[model samples]
Target chain A: MKISKEEVEHIAKLARLEIDEKEKERFAHQLSDVLNHMEKLDQLDTEYVEPTSHILPIHNVFKGDEIKEVFPMADPLSNAPQKDHGHYRVPKIVE
Target chain B: MDYEAIIGLEVHTQLLTKSKIFCSCSTQFGAKPNQHTCPICLGMPGVLPVLNRDVVEFTIRTALATNCRIAPSNRFARKNYFYPDLPKGYQISQYELPLAMDGYIEIGSNETKKRIGITRIHMEEDAGKLIHGENLGHPDSSYVDFNRTGVPLMEIVSEPDIRAPEEAREYLLKLKAILEYIEVCDCNMEEGNLRCDANISVRPEGRREFGVKAELKNMNSFKNVQRALEYEIKRQVQTLEKGEEIVQETRLWDVNSERTISMRSKEEAHDYRYFPEPDLVPTVISEDWIEDVRSKLPELPDAKKERFVREYGIPEYDAGVLTSSRSLADYYEACVRLFPNPKIISNWVMGDILRELKDDERGISECPITPGHLTGMLRMIEDGRISGKIAKIVFEEMYRSGKMPDEVVKEKGLVQISDEGELLIFVDRVIEENPDMVEAYQKGKTKLFGYFIGEVMKASKGKANPALVNKFLKDRLDCNV
Candidate 1:
């Protein structure tokens, strides 16, 4: 369950982080601690215990097959950092 | 060169509940960024989570629809991850005991029923969407919209039983139909209602153990899911043939390029650091509650399809298509009850009505013609009040004016000309004018008889009853001529 230095560096890169050297060493220890704790499940007698995926037993939950309303586009771009009328605005490329 | 592609899908559907899984925020889509979020979803300090009862009920409904075995007791687990979209660093999801497991959905045509095994259906919260444009100069940083954070989502995983791209698409379509019938999720891919992430791998012919699998992401549509899987299967098989190992990685589906690019190594289930959520207790759902939900369950698609075939006497294919959506089946049955002809009702719903609705991007509810109007039109044809060709005109007028079929036919003066005496004069004139056509008809050229009949009907301004015209034309041409 221990995370090696190389593994921590790889995970950091995958997560797109610009971490310092000291932070990498620290995260290695923290991640290893978390994984070690999770590994405790392996010690339990789960031979007969089935892995659970959902919590309810109900099925066929549906609504009336009707298109209630048109696609709402009014508010998605209201709080955008930039906006051009109704769409989310971004910077132009042409000089 | 002798191998098959075995593919299976893991679909995550956001249930259309009125609130989040653990909070009271509205589960509505397309709101202002972060407007639906609160302390519980934001994972603020001292904010405890409570399970939404509706979400659990919805999960059970989906399990029963897919013929899954419901668990007597299940609990929530914290799937630990660090992402901006997920306000809680650890997402509350099902892990050790899910609500349902070991269900199967029948796909493909009736003659070739392929049973796709559903491994599990679990509940989780949706993460926020990433709006990638902040820090425009740097081209690295992206803004995150937390509006979708903590929305209730059910992740249904299927066993790797699919062997082709078409079967993969069929599985998704059938599952979406079931979801739509059961009224759990909207199943709208365009609005991000029903989304799929496919796990695919290729193996040597007749090999027992599975090969290194790659998880494909960002497939927005069912077609894209199928195409991306096909492309990945080819790429993986080629890499393995070149003696290169097919690494277990997470790949992004570049929809524009129609190829998969490796993103990172696939994480194992244990890597998520899953543990029981301390905020919520293990839910012990009662059998009485399950039975109550079951009693309220509507007739599912398969049973309805069978009934439509047996009771209505429609073909299996027509019944299948009609029962694809509950609304469509209801509309068809309503028309049938009024008209009492399954074949005619099927034709209208599957033909002009569906074509018109699809072309205009509308649904059955949006159609101008009501089921009553459609039945009235069929009745006109049945009673020989109007010809089938004229019924088409009446239908168009009905759609345009929102008028009843009888009113449209009356206003347009579209009544059939069934007057045998009046039609005999027109038939005599046609037979006298086209003597050669009559002679040709008598000489075993039966096909040309339709031409003469057409002339008679056209001469009568399309109001001539087709059956009477045929009888008059045959009598005048054969005996009198």
Candidate 2:
């Protein structure tokens, strides 16, 4: 399957990226090429193999339900673009 | 032509776990903003996430309670989206293969039982809260509180089986009761611990296909959910009747306006590129673990209701009301143990106690009147220590003062006047003062006997035993001769 220009534009919009027409066209072709290359794996007969969600062989990685000391407010808001009363401030987000 | 509303609810209940789903940050509510943030929850560079085992157990517990089929293995996925409240720009959730599926919850009363299918129950991490600054005269800025971020939540999606607003509300109440019964969630809608969003559509009667649906949000209570759905159903039916198309959208239920405003159109749909979370491994639940959780499960609402009707000889409706909450059920059982008259106890609890609790916005656990106090009052009525009318006064005092029934009776001097010597005086006085009524009774008016009985009770200040007053009045009036 090939990715279309509209699909590329849709993905860009969802990611909140403003892509020009030229960039949309270029990325459309490049992404389709990547998809076509990835599709070559479908030619192999792997029906007996189970579909894997993760690459690792490990499962059930968990920790007990207990609280640990939280990071101080200064550490997280330090990297935020805007700070307000120990909270991260950003442009207003409507529901 | 009548149109029917088709509704489905998506409920997100925050699990009562100690920590966040994938971090060790405390999951306590009402904390200062950003106080619960850790590197993993804040999405700091190169930090990995480990799932909280309690979250998984809670999900399985809920699944089993709702009669769901638990998947032997489940994996987490990253639902990529952009929101200021979500620091990682993606929420870790179960998709494609959820923790449980194909479950059902029965709503409605015994005679009209309706099964609402649960399509899936998936574990997810909640996003943080956004404190809007529009009210503060700053329309361009908002503050993000990360306290709720990464908190364990279960998104329970129901199939489109609800046919009316009442059914939708019933479905939610039943689900909430089950959750509270299992002690998995607090199910506090006002505090946002349990939030519900509804998908509603309208179709003509006898139509097989579903109409275009609009998702409704911001319904803070069960009443609001019913009202919002009613408004949406009317709006959709009107739109369809006018030969107009129903555009799919997400609508906000404005509490003040009592209307749904379109928030987002279909064109603005986000493509949440879902993929497996690389940091977290798959969860493998063994059969032994499922059975252990099953064995720990308490008797749910339906089974308890049945047992109540069978054992207590109460009506199904009474059983349902008493067993609606675990605390209320315990209260009923305690009263039954003391009084052993389940029907009368049910009447008092369901009638007077429930009304008082509702008026004060209190729950059974917070009720001032204890079960012993209530049953003690009923015992006074049973033994004729106090008339039923006088018991009401004592009950009110007991409820207000948290005192025992006998204590209230003693304080008020409201004991019954059941002795013949005490009641005979009042009967003779009533007969002497009401000569015209006696003449009327002798002339065969007959119902004037009730008048004499009323006068005797009134003359005794309502302390006269009603049965004794009746016998004395009949004898004095010569009605039995």
Candidate 3:
């Protein structure tokens, strides 16, 4: 397989995902298959093709710098799992 | 073997925008927690991020000022990371195609001027503030304030051309001055309006290849940037000398400990996984837009400094000091309009005015003495209305009470004693009181001439015209009149 088990584990850790050993094995095989299918594009000889950044022809979408009223929704931190003092509280992440 | 340090700086300065970059929320500092966040900045589902029009204009202004080539087209990208400060799982920034590239700012200490290459200047969104500990009585959890989140930032990356820590400082100072002159950033380091991080490496003096490097962060001031680089370079040199490889890592400048400490190792670091932002459209810049930004750019520091020297005939050093800040240059020019003596005005501004402001740690804008008062005081010296010594006293009282120079001089009786008859009375008293000095002066003790002058100046309470006193004393003492 192009994607090793350790590589799959590393990728999962970077995304902060939790998976058991069986799920890791399955993801390794699945990711390698997806990459192998994507590799078929390498056979195309289209060196002159212009790389595409956006599919749409639109550009320069900007809003004026003037301040407008903020969209009033429910309290911003109301849905947090833990909140205090008008702040969204998370686990301690000090340096 | 002597080791040379190679340093590169990544300076992030917050732009002075009326609203946040991607949203319409007010970008005011010190707002309530999460007060400035909207659905877009907070990364809510189904929300799209739109660019602020002024951010692009301001970025173009800086790019032109730094001689950077603005990209014909640019787009935002997502820098994926996980931190409490970043509400979104990824930060919207420019990755491969930044707005501008290949700029340079000149820095010099002494007479040696050098160009420090600016690699890129890209626009990005700032992260929120993370509060740890029980500072706000949230003891058990870390709190995040999104007030600063999504505020526009321009990250200027420098080429790895800095050879020393002091050069790094010079580069930051020049960049800060340029940004301020262009009226783009406030350039206030204390309030987090401007931030800097540096990456440094050390190699033997004549070696070509670079050594392992450590990234330094959390330097709150420019002085701290230089100090941190110095400490890290020394540490790396020692590590290399001890036959140990310098570990590649990120370090934090511990303020209290006065040294750089390891913040994270390479093994624990995760890739940013940058990808083009799908929600935002690419920004295309035409020649007209660049020209429009170029035309509106203000007079930068170097050009203004040169003009000061050429037009005002002041020394290069004096012009450099006067044009250090835009307001200060304006102050000097205003005084010159009224007084028309550049060297004299430069002396007062650089010596007395700057000293007074520095003691209180204030900018020239906050100074109480106006240009009218300054030129008014200087005019007294020119018009023979007050002595130079007394003008110093008048200037202080004027600054303290925010009074005009004429009012201060009148209230304190600080006018010059220039009249010949008014001077003769004090002169006669001095010669009478010191008969030995007078006789000795008649016997060719010409050195005692200064003694007579001192006594007369004291009797007149330091308001005597020195030129008149000299003429009167020479006539009286040389012939025993």
Candidate 4:
């Protein structure tokens, strides 16, 4: 149940995180410990239990298709670090 | 070596819902940039995403129309990717469980009906529009429009059942027509309401295994989709012939170049770590609810097309062209109700009306000439008030000026002259002028009869009743001979 260092590095890259070599090794060890502990639950046999993505008892929460109050464009643009006429500006993504 | 292309299509159509999928922001297009966005859609911290009830209902309608099996329970997953268009680090999409599955859309290709298997239809939130700085004179940065963010989209994925590029276009068109019939998506590709991507691979003829596949993007129109797939298949086959492997990557259809250019990124780089969304709960649809949605489904394109052929007795091709849109089909049916000759209505609609609409890139709903106006003009032709040729001119005027058929005919003075007394003058003038043609007709050059009819028609400015002109010209020419 040991996570490889390469696996940790790949995970970091997918999350857009830049980690040093030492951090990659440390993360691999720590993540493996966490997964191994979670894997210990395999001892329990609840064959009839329905696997669920969320443990919450609630389901099917929906809002009607009614338009609420319209918010001003300036509010969100003000929070942006860089904006151009109510549009959020970011580095161009060519590809 | 010959290669057969195995193409699969992925289509994303924006649902015609009033509100955004997770927020109450208006889903109206062409608003000011970022005007329709809210905190939830902007991915602000500490906001719960609520599904819109209309989105699922629309999904049920679409799934039923496509003959898909609706999933009793489904949940949304977060697809993690970093792009400026997506305000959230991940897009909220369905991963493990989709809304519906195992559908087949039957399309007419090469005079045969082929059923393309639909793999799945999943609901997801649309990303925002990114206006690249280079295109807008702001060279280093891009502007983002969040107005399109959080728009509900149904991603319909088809199985690799399409064997040719033409079949792919047929499949896409059939799907668009179905969406239009259900009134779920606008299916306007130019406005980005309906977008398509294709996955194409070529294998040696009769090979059991599949060749490497490339994903094609940015095909904004159905024509471009077929062109892009054709170009991609050629590129792959050429690579295989050169003993070079076809690279597995995403390529974009360049409309200007008329070929697909490699996007220079491999699929491995876009590792979307998908996980179930914690905020939004699973949707569990009941049998009664599914039945209710199914009962509300409109008559889809295929059924309507078949009925048009059987009920109206029009050609299958005419029925297809007319039934391409729901409103157009309704227009045809309304015209038929007013005028019992369905074949004639089909000819006028498919020939003249659609030609005008296609030229202007307009829809039937936007047509100035309604079914009433069309049927009114057809009655004029039936009664010989206007000849068929003159009716075309009158119809054009009615379409252009949005006037009634009578008004156009009156304003343009396009009444057919069925009075033999009035047409006899033009007939005698033509026979008197064409002495050589007259002598030729007497000398058994009877093909000159068409020449006499033509001269009279020309002199009358195409207003003479063709039948009367023929009868009068024959009598004038024969009696003189």
Best by DockQ: 3
What digit string (tens of lDDT, one per residue) describes model 4 on residues B1-481? 8899999999999999999999999998888888888889999888888999999999989889988999999999999888888888889999999999999999873378788999999999999999989776579989999899999999999999999999998898889999989999999898899999999999999999999999999999889999999898889999999999998889999999998998776566677878889889999999999999888888888888889889989888888888888999999999999999999998888889889999998988999999889999999998999988898899889999999988888888888888878898888888788788789899899998898888888888889999888888777778876
Which window of ten consecutive residues has the lowest lDDT sum in model 3 chain B?
A: B262-271
1 versus 2: better lDDT goes to: 2
Residue B387 of model 3 has an lDDT of: 83
Model 3 CA deviation exceeding 4 Å by range: B265-267
What lDDT does each candidate get? 0.82, 0.90, 0.90, 0.90
Which pairs in model 4 have colliding backbones?
Answer: none
List residue ranges in candidate 2 displaced over 4 A: A19-22, A70-76, B135-137, B265-269, B479-481
Residue B161 displacement in candidate 2 (angstroms): 1.1
TM-score for each model: 0.84, 0.95, 0.97, 0.95
- Going through the candidates in the order shown, the clash numbers are 24, 0, 0, 0
DockQ numbers for every candidate? 0.08, 0.68, 0.74, 0.69
lDDT of 1 by residue, B240-325 (tens): 88989988888888978888988653454236768877667667767897888888789999899999999989999999889988
* lDDT (10s digit) by residue, model 3, range B1-481: 9999999999999999999999999999877788777888888889988899999999999999999999999989999988888878899999999999999988883389899999999999999998985786656678888888999999999999999998998888889889989998999887889999998999999999998888899999988998999899889999999999998888999889899998664447568889999989999999999999888888998999989989999888888888888999999999999999888999999999999999999899998999999999989988888888888899899889999998998888888899889899999989899998788888888898998989999999989998889999988887664
Assign candidate 3 its CAPRI class. medium
- List all candidate RMSDs to the true structure: 6.3, 2.1, 1.5, 2.1
- What TM-score would you give candidate 1 relative to the actual structure? 0.84
Candidate 2 lDDT, B1-481, residue by residue in tens? 7998889999999999999999999999888788888888988888899999999999999999999999999999999988888889899998898999999999988779889999999999999988888754467888888989999999999999999999998999999999999999999898889999999999999999999999999999989999999999989989998999898988999999999999765446567889988888899999999999999999999999999999999999899888889999999999999999999999899999999999999999999999999999999998989888888888889999998888888888899999999898999898889788788789889988888877887888788889888887877778434
